[model samples]
Target: MLNRTAKFLTICLLAQPLPPAALTVTAAASENAALRDISKIQVDERRLTEAVASRTLTWLTGSPANNDYISVGRLANFFGFVGLRVTSGHSLKRSEVARETLSVLTEQQRTQMVSLVHAQKDTLNRAHEARQEMNRALEGLLAFEHVTREQFIELGRDYGAREAELGRLLAQTFGDIAQTLSTDQQRALTDIRTTHLSGERRQGNGGGDPKLRQSKADKKELVNLTARFLSWTTGSQEFNDFEVVGKPSQHFGFVALRIGSNHGVKRGLVAKEVLEILTPSQIDRLREAALQNAREFPMFLEVRAQLMRVLETSLSGGVIDPAHTAHLGAEIGEIEASMTWSQAAAMLDVRDGLSEAQSADLLAMRAKYTAETDSSDLDDPIERGRQLFAQCAFCHNSDSRQPIGPPLDDIVGKPIASDPAFKRYSPALVRYARAQSMWTEAQLDAFLKSPKALVPGTFMSFDGYEETDDRSALIAYLKTRK
Candidate 1:
């Protein structure tokens, strides 16, 4: 009875399908459809073989002889059967055969073939890593979950089924390459499928307490974190593992900190700190800004979503591991934060316009506020503006010859309405230019603060500069242009 049961188990294991191999085969089949015509050529197999062999020899030895003639004769005989007359024309040459084969492939078919090959290569690599991870997780299960060897194996099978499902989805969505897979590749995939199946069977039959099962779920949750971190770092949503555990609500102070801490944002320090940061007025402005700058700032929605997620994560006791935390911090630091309204209108230097009492009032309102004296005279306004303009490099170029927008070089001195070469300018701009004088530094500064407001009909769709300093720096930088 024992031997019979063992044999039954082995049979069950052998019956399980190999997902990677299946996927590989699927891809291979797709490629073979295009190669089939070439393969079907009715050539004298021996002669064609000899010709290929002699050609390889000639390449290696740098010599041609009677033996090569024999190979050529064989090739000619093969071509004769195919109705290709080598003696009459060059149509029967080897290069001609290659050209014919290439000509037979449609553009779409060629693209599909290349895509399939690349997908297969990537899938093979990922599947290998997945298998290794599955194995390691199983081995470590004893340490992490205190499960028996049988239990561990059973758990592995369940995970394998889930992985197989993912693989199937990937193959369907990304295209399959299994038909082209080699025997060895098929064998490896088969082994993985078999192992997973065996594990699933074990888990189903070896029943355990409900509480223990719950604990297993918790352990899986932790293991999932590692997977999620990897996915996040790799910039793919398919491998998303993190789950939001709480409800979303607005908490201005919390929102401010979260936004500040976010990777690549550095704006709204004091206003964000205000307990009621998003006041009715501020909210209206933001909504209007969103509407006005929708095209220029399509990524705002994504940024806001991430901000909410960070808020939820912070409120919950869930700590993103140190590595992920550091990476997020770095990304946030890279962002050039916008200034508040007051900051934008401040004097360019010396702060002569602001009274001490006004400055003190601003500092008193914020929980964390520190004032730094600008006594060093090291603040090169042009250099500061250049630093701020770095953020705009992704979508704009200062060089007029190569730019998404009209180049800013010598833009200040140009006539408001004329530049025939600038085809992309909005009609509103041409109208404005016809009516108004050339753009002055102060006018440019205000326009930079709120682009839509100044020229409602213009196409310069940037979300207005968020900070007074940033706007000033940008204006200063623009002034340096001839």
Candidate 2:
């Protein structure tokens, strides 16, 4: 209902105008009436379209962060306990720990630890390989306008299997690593991890932070913050998938505290993400804002409820009443203006506050995180088909509903315009459907290439696809709808 296109940078936040005084109720009363109406309204949640989910998820991917936020002391403890060498009072590369064994452990223990490490290594490598494979699979899916259920499910299964195998090996490795350490060393490790890994998993955390231990109150507040963000973004917390929280965010231009894109893990705890970033001062500011924001967030929600109320009460039966339209539009118009101004102000503040170096860093990070435009997903036939399909969507519903134009659903195998339910089809298509047995692939291709040529008197106004590849792709997409 809001005008997303208009810039409201110069908006004046004057008191919102009342619904034309002729309305029997005051502004406060109208809004209260709307709130009550909406409170009782029940509607099914809307899940994102598959194409949107895939595309957003793809954007969330690309280059993963590959570094440490952990402290040196914790790192030394972890390495030493894991049977890795950590010479005292000497700075060494983090990778150096992987190459050498601690002299404190017996040779037999070393041998056992090495074997366990080798097994862990193999499992980790396999998971990495599967992730690479899954990346390719996702690339293909994102490029397609339409995909069969089997395609997404099959790829998800492949990735799920690898994640499960990796998780099992990782758990085993933790126990095995502890076994190699002396009791005192194991205690040292536990003490070091007390803050860093408290309530957090130790495996593959993108080299997590040691400074991220949170109090119960802090953890509860973070949970509430996460719930609010999810609500704002997804329109509902339930509007989510069982994919890795971070992975989908890679696509959706947001961040999630999720671990990986393995099955069933919806998100990473907000505390872990904070630990990963380890910017406590900024986090404190954000947390304070979040607490305040969450309490006030309901106002924006009520705006939506208020709009729906206006639409319902203002309309005459199923049609808009010209008399009420002006009043209805004004209420929505003010809300949109305020929101636009606030959003623009936030961006402006960021832009104004950034130093040249910080700006450059942000630019560079954005570049690194963004997917390569020339990636294979760009060249996939399904992607090309999807781009072409957007033009057609203006007139056709894939699900064959809404009667805006003839639906393409089942148009591949069914005789053209033969649906007894669809009377809006042009007479030309009607006659053709009566004469033709079924719409073959060749027929679809030819029709897409030149609709007017195929049926001279057709009511359809599409300027057909001029390129052979475009028509072929269109026909290919249509064929799969059945």
Candidate 3:
């Protein structure tokens, strides 16, 4: 907990009035202070969050009347968006904005989209159910100290298959909606997906973000500053269950954060990276925009967090009270009333401020950093093995340090329970080791290929690589031993 003195200082720093300095960030300290303040406010206002959340249950029923655009077919996704609403600031409020194209559409066209969304309730429900099952499996991992090898392997496979089925159903639902839109509206939709929704300012970008990292020290400070805002993201199991199941994104990707629900992209770190190519004047503009964004983020994030709790709870535990849902709507209205819609326009200023060539470079840089493998290196088994090891990097360190799992250092020759550095070995693994002592290549292969069948209660959360070559490659890399 922060001292009262410290917390008040932080709020003062953030709320300090800035001089009217168009694009220039006149006070860097004030900007930093605002960000810290906003993050703190988001984290500390627990009751406010719950109160607002109790009102958003209406979201489960249908889109409410608002200045915001609505489509019956897109309602589920809209609900998801509302759940994700706090990432940006400004006119993106649940109120305040509407799509010009959507506004002009005929009632019948709107009804068609809603009808299509209604039609897929069964498919969506199935996907939701499968996801719940996976969440239960993952919850087991969270509850126990060590995952049995069998649990680890089976959970991996089950999670992957479930995701695939859900993805297909969602794709079909979205496709049906897309088909209903006119060409112009379709273009508008694409623009929303690729442009307005995309925070990228540069042009000619193929796709994906560069996996640039900022200094660890700076990032640690950013994390501390935003710890409150990050509490639910990093600590909430419900939030964790809903995050994307794929590999962590390489760079700041298409979305701001790909580091799982653990944290938002270190915005200060990303800002440092993105600002590198911009001119000094452009840097000032972006800085100003960031500071302005800081002002509204605290309120926005708090409301969104509460709403997420409501949604995730409903998804897992069934519907919440209607009164809470109504309160949430009221909260949204309150926040919208006070918010100054500057960030989006400021974002545009930053976008237009950048030269076209810089945009191209930014795009190219991200694409280069996108998690693409070098085709030329495919012939080398060792190279392929290293490539296959990336997924494991999420939880296991090659060094002696344990991440989520034991380190891989000299793992090939290690006695099952003999690694002195690892203090919390699973009992199942220890008992298995009594019969077979060492981690031989065959044991490794089977474990890597299918962990659940091999050791049912092990704590490893990875799904085994089904491809023979991929598993071989990963094993090959492991043999090298850091």
lDDT of 1: 0.31
What is the TM-score of candidate 1?
A: 0.24
Better of 1 and 3 by lDDT: 3
Q: Tens digits of per-residue lDDT for model 3 on 44-145? A: 222222212211111111111110111222212212232122322211222111222234234564444344444545655553454333333322222222
Over 127-159, each residue of candidate 1 has an lDDT whose tens digit, in order, gives: 334333333332222112233434433333333
State each model's CA lDDT, in order.
0.31, 0.35, 0.37
For model 2, residues 328-446, the per-residue Cα lDDT tens digits are 32433233233222222222223233333433343333343322222122355654564455435434542323334666766777777777666677788878877676788888887
- Model 2 global lDDT (CA atoms, 0 to 1): 0.35
Clashing pairs in 2: 56-251, 59-250, 59-251, 60-250, 60-251, 61-250, 143-383, 144-382, 257-268, 258-268
Per-candidate count of clashing residue pairs (backbone under 3 Å) = 26, 10, 25
TM-scores across all candidates? Answer: 0.24, 0.28, 0.28
Task: Provide the lDDT at 100 for model 3.
Answer: 27
C-alpha lDDT (0 to 100) for residue 248 of candidate 2: 18
